[model samples]
Target chain A: MCVNMDLMATTLPLLDTAVAKCCAEPGSAPLDRDEADAVARLLKAVADPVRLQIISIVRCSEGGEVCACDLPSPLGLAQPTVSHHLKVLVDAGLLERERRGQWAWFSLVPERLELARRALGT
Target chain B: MCVNMDLMATTLPLLDTAVAKCCAEPGSAPLDRDEADAVARLLKAVADPVRLQIISIVRCSEGGEVCACDLPSPLGLAQPTVSHHLKVLVDAGLLERERRGQWAWFSLVPERLELARRALGT
Candidate 1:
């Protein structure tokens, strides 16, 4: 278990780096195609109404974390639909998921969201 | 002509109000459908690579504006494609366009971008 945990730690930074590289400030300079593509991918992840609401709900939840099971009713979405949106956010590095018993709980990946905010360069 | 200008002035705030109403801080609370939809539309406008690059280039340009004709080469896109992206940005209120002779110039609408930044609540 310790070896498995060590391996997991080593792999996570690589994902963070990928997110960071794509989120370079857009107002700082003209973005090349690759930078633009990466940044756009991040934006697209949050570009849907359902996804935007999901992020908002997760961010504002008490203790800064929310359970996947608790999301659907407030969102007025079905379970599968909410799950799909959560998956998209998790894939985007905007949210991290942890399994607690039989259910997954989510917390904001604050750094990733900050990178997205800065990428907008407002 | 003065009446036309006055009419334009009178009409613009309603549009601004609409944009403003929808861009409320997302982290403040869960977003209702309309607010989420409006925010999503703004995100969608900037959610493409070419459009994101256009925004960056325009923001970084001298005098805070760029002519429509100058965008294609840097973006490696054709004029018509660039124009379509510009229209999307303008329609979303993230950009304002001015016609100077035969060329159209574009500049950022700082407030709109700021609202988007705040909406992200990072």
Candidate 2:
């Protein structure tokens, strides 16, 4: 389902209230324009089919995390391309990385997902 | 933050479980590849700031619904452009549209949002 915003004004109140509650600091710093831009970039990062599919696959793997070594084979993508994508995800704070010998295992950071979810609300 | 799938291996289990539970069709069919693409497109649709902002504004508005007329002014975008974005959102099933008199108001469909959320899981 493609959800374009112009048709989604109704869900705005709850969505906005959710975002407002999360992003609006309580008597403290709030999300600035630049911050919003940054967050938007992050959202943009996973907005693609390939990226979204990767997320689903990783989450569906044996553990909540997966070794990068096993990735490219399934995707039929080049190792460098996968590495670049991983870097982007890492930069966004959406994933955390741990290097064990030759394997680099990356996993989801739930708080980041929660935070992004909140961004949607505001 | 932008969650690249390369880094979200961790959130996979929970996300996948959630999606499987919701969309696995009980004892029926499961999400196929084509379905995955469709859902991913919906996410891709809202990956941009312009569309995301429209969501925020519409949800943040009074009663969680906003008229098409009041949209362009805030974004400083042309009416047709705004209309196009709205059409995209509507097509994605994220936003629902209603026409009353001379105005066309669009609002968020929470179930659709929830469905997208589920898609993130599996």
Candidate 3:
């Protein structure tokens, strides 16, 4: 009855396993349900506007990193909102956050981005 | 008032412009607000799991692409749902769709992916 593999309420793990194997062995064969799902969840995390912008700004910053405290003003957004977005991006492995003094700084994780780029297989 | 450069609700276009120029010129230094915002939006598009899987499946396909009609069954999804996901990926310039005889075939756009890789500057 489900048209989208994503429609299945409990298919997350199955999809993730499928994608994990597929990404782990790119030249082997097509990705299974589990692997595909894992990769998707990661993507979904980065799919929101707020999260993406946070990533872009930090990536484009000098040294490809930014301090958590300096982020809110340029975006003209509330502190909590920006913090929430940063949390999402960092959790997804796309951005790496580190604590220094009383502030946290973020920078892009090139390996993760490279993994996505490689997924294109183009 | 804001902590993130992304705190501003109306800064979408500004970020977009900044990212466009930055991407258009990769060798350049840090991205401006508009450029970062734009890049973030594009990243936002591919951030969803369903969308990422669709791209992944198509990318892992035999010819680095896939036929729309042949996709749903493998992913255990429905037609309309899969179609919606494809539209998002295509709209983002990550995948290209072409009509041939009885179905649509989608292939990755390497150039776009390459641009993204360059954006990492790592």
Candidate 4:
């Protein structure tokens, strides 16, 4: 499951506090239980080669969204597998998908990527 | 198994080329086979709750390092479990571990984290 910053902050005050403080002044403290869980969920979503490529493809799409029909051939993955990875990314809040006609178009959620980058203090 | 940037660049020029070009100009293209594999390896390492906490703890340590003995208590995880996580991070090039007397010290690899951040264009 993807944990958004707002939900995480409200649901996990301790972790939210830690993340806020850490972001303001990094290397100040370790992530508490809830914080780690929230961050881990996001990281796990993008932890696979296929998923990473999917993100890259959608991110680089000319129209800012990629059609599901256009993905499998570039990565040499089957259509079903590509759809599965896209589902995982969408579930993790990293990508937004829209069904138009017979195609599913995916776009990158830059904020979520930024959150994970900040969590790693990158 | 963990994949390092250097090995990936040399072994998979197609992906390495994509990464180099992409890094120079963000969102220019998708990750080829090797680049995705290399990045996925690193992301997978930090994708777990315990491992993320461990990295956070070590990064925030006073001495720029933390002893293995000190991790379990703060994280509330079993010692063996913590060690296993540490090993995974080390293998992924995200953390470095050195045995000192009776304890193993772990430290964050900031450059590696930066590489990931750049990869995500965050």
The numbered model that scores best in lDDT is 1
How much is the lDDT of residue B103 in candidate 1? Answer: 100
Return the TM-score for each candidate structure. 0.79, 0.70, 0.66, 0.82
Candidate 3, residues A1-122, lDDT tens digits: the string is: 23432343465455445545445333445665556556566656654656655666665566767898887887878989998888777666678888999999888887776555554343
lDDT of candidate 1 over A14-110, digit per residue (tens): 4344334434343445666776777787778888888887777876676778899998988898999999899888877788999999899998888
Error of model 2, residue A82, in angstroms: 1.7
Q: What is the lDDT of residue A41 in candidate 4?
A: 75
Per-residue lDDT tens digits for candidate 1, residues B1-122, read: 45634743664554344344434343455676766776777778888888888887887676888999999999988999999899888877789999999999999998877766665664
What's the C-alpha lDDT at position B2 in model 2?
Answer: 34
Provide the interface RMSD of candidate 4 in angstroms, 1 decimal place.
2.5
Q: State each model's TM-score restricted to chain B.
A: 0.76, 0.70, 0.70, 0.78
lDDT of 4 by residue, B35-108 (tens): 78877776787778888778777777777789999988999989998888887887666787788999988888
Q: How well is candidate 3 docked (DockQ)?
A: 0.23
Between prediction 3 and prediction 4, the one with superior DockQ is 4
Task: For all candidates, state DockQ relative to the true structure.
Answer: 0.40, 0.18, 0.23, 0.55
Ranking by DockQ: 4, 1, 3, 2
- Which candidate number has the best DockQ? 4
TM-score of 3: 0.66
